[model samples]
Target: MFKKFSPSTDISGQTPVKSSMQRAIRSSILSSWNIDAETLEAIWPKKESIIHVKCREHISIYTLHNEPLFFQHFDGPVYPTLRLLHKYPFILPHVGIDRGAIRFLLAGANMMCPGLTSKGGRLPPQDAALPAGTPVAIDAEGKEFAVGIGLTTIGTEEMKKINKDVAVESVTYVGDELWAVQKL
Candidate 1:
């Protein structure tokens, strides 16, 4: 979806997020993520209000001090920018892709099941299975930081069973246009 994202042409307006909405977001974030209060405050301070940066195609970027933290496409789950995921690695569940698939992912290709089900790839165990459409941090084999953020197209067990098709739909990656916009 962000294959050709150009901020200048895509952004429509910037507005200060309202306090009520801020509380809603704050609580929603707190409830949705596994982060502690201290960590959440450090990322989004109570004193600094979040800026709602509107873009084309119903994309809403939430920022603080001009640095993009997370974004939402339409009303979908909030996806932390790759930068944010790098800082607080445990906020979301993870799905790892093999080294061979890193190049394809960097090129903005959707992840196929083989890349994630192979020896190098990693997925949650059956006991910790995640449902479809869950937000996930995509890690690379032997990498400390996540390479991308995406939504699971199917359950982990399903991916293991059906290993030929797309597994995770890439939302944002390390070299995508969204990753380039660190500020504004």
Candidate 2:
């Protein structure tokens, strides 16, 4: 099941990160998601670097890369815990969303889902992978923005109970309240 997170749970505290390292992390995240360098750089910017959870659970951020396409496969880290998915790979978020609600929506499904908690665009039907409650925003042209991350239940039916019509089995609640204006 997708677990929830809160501010008090921030184990990393507000530690500052180096710019070169930030660039590397952004590149890694883009590569893992198979986003091209050009697009990723456009959406996210090199100067914008910071990582934090919107709610206790969701990972919210804007990236140096603008590939909203990457968010369709929202399989980075499931929850906003101190733990990293090194078992698979690790790529820290650069610009995080500021609101919990947007975080919840992104955590729940890709931009493709209808009726997002906030009104943004949608993603394509490519093999998108949802982690849990990850919320994403799409541009008018259908690109994606990794607005916030999500927590999910293991089974699809269970997720539907929390949010009906949501295709993925994971249920998403908004992680950050300010994510709408920031990312979208």
Candidate 3:
């Protein structure tokens, strides 16, 4: 793994993490994909930091071997890597059709007056997990269309007005589960 590739370590000489906190992170991946413990350990960065998992994989700190392959090969019975972390267990970013409109917003979306541009219905309030620069998905009336990417902004209104200069927030996913399955 070191000849053709080089894994990085911080100044303290710690290896990458094996993300093993947060029941949401682990359970979502395992229950959805039937992943095992050994597999989860192999792909994660081997760190024990809460912030890293909360903000998704620490892409800046330790990158995957090949993210595209990681996703493609693993999109099986379970959802792809991104959906595993974005839905099911996570409470912050919720996906639901609020008041008959399919709205994908953060969990604490303004219910009384949902600032939805399109479909808002009876779906859950889970943050749609979007890849950076990719469109998020919203399904209403059996139709699925790509919405704008989930923003770093907190509310639906702020997301509409985000400018090019705004700082990018990290996207979350379960790459470890994919990697583990791929290795098998």
Candidate 4:
């Protein structure tokens, strides 16, 4: 989504979020992700204010102190920015791809089932199976940090069974335009 993004042109305006909206966003994030109250507070303190960065393509990036924290595409699932994910690695579920697919992913390609079901790819076990449209962090094999953030196009088990076609749709990657914008 951020492949050709230009901050200067794409960003429409920046405004501080209302207190009521802040409470709603906090509650929404708390319920969707597996994070504790203390950790959330640490990332976004009660005193510090949040900025709503309106960009092209219906992208709404929420920032704390000018750093992009999370974003939403229309009303779809809220995604933690890659930087935010790096700081709080456990905020979202992880899916690993083999070294062979790293180059493709870096080019902003959607994750394929074969790459995920192969020897190098890793997916959550059936006990923790995730449904389609869930946000996830895409990790590279043997890498310590996630390379990208994406949403599941199909369930984890389905990816394993089908073993073909797209599994996850890439949203933001390491070298994408969004990552280049550290502060907004």
Clashes of each: 0, 47, 30, 0
Per-residue alpha-carbon lDDT of model 1 for 1-184, expressed as tens digits? Answer: 6778888899999999999988988887887777888999999989999999999999999999999998999988888888998989999999999999999999999999999999999999999999999889999999989999889999999999999899999999999999988899
Mind giving the per-residue lDDT tens digits that candidate 3 earns over 39-109?
A: 65554443533222111222222224433111211222212334333332231233333334323122212
Q: Candidate 4, 82: how far from true, in Å?
A: 0.8
**Deviation of model 3 at 151, angstroms:** 3.3
**lDDT of residue 148 for candidate 4:** 99
Q: Give the 10-residue window scoring lowest on summed lDDT in candidate 1.
A: 25-34
> lDDT per model, in order?
0.92, 0.34, 0.30, 0.94
Of the candidates shown, which would achieve the greatest lDDT relative to the real structure?
4
Tens-digit per-residue lDDT, 69-108, candidate 4: 9999998888899998999999999999999999999998
Best by TM-score: 4
Clashes of 3: 30
CA-only RMSD, every prediction: 1.0, 11.2, 12.6, 0.8
Segments in model 2 whose C-alpha atoms lie over 4 Å from true places: 1-15, 51-184
True-structure Cα RMSD, model 2: 11.2
For candidate 2, write residues 1-184 as lDDT tens digits: 2233333453224333467756755666565443467655554555666542232233443222221112212335323211122111223221122233344444544322333322442322224433443322222223233433333322223332343344333322233332222222
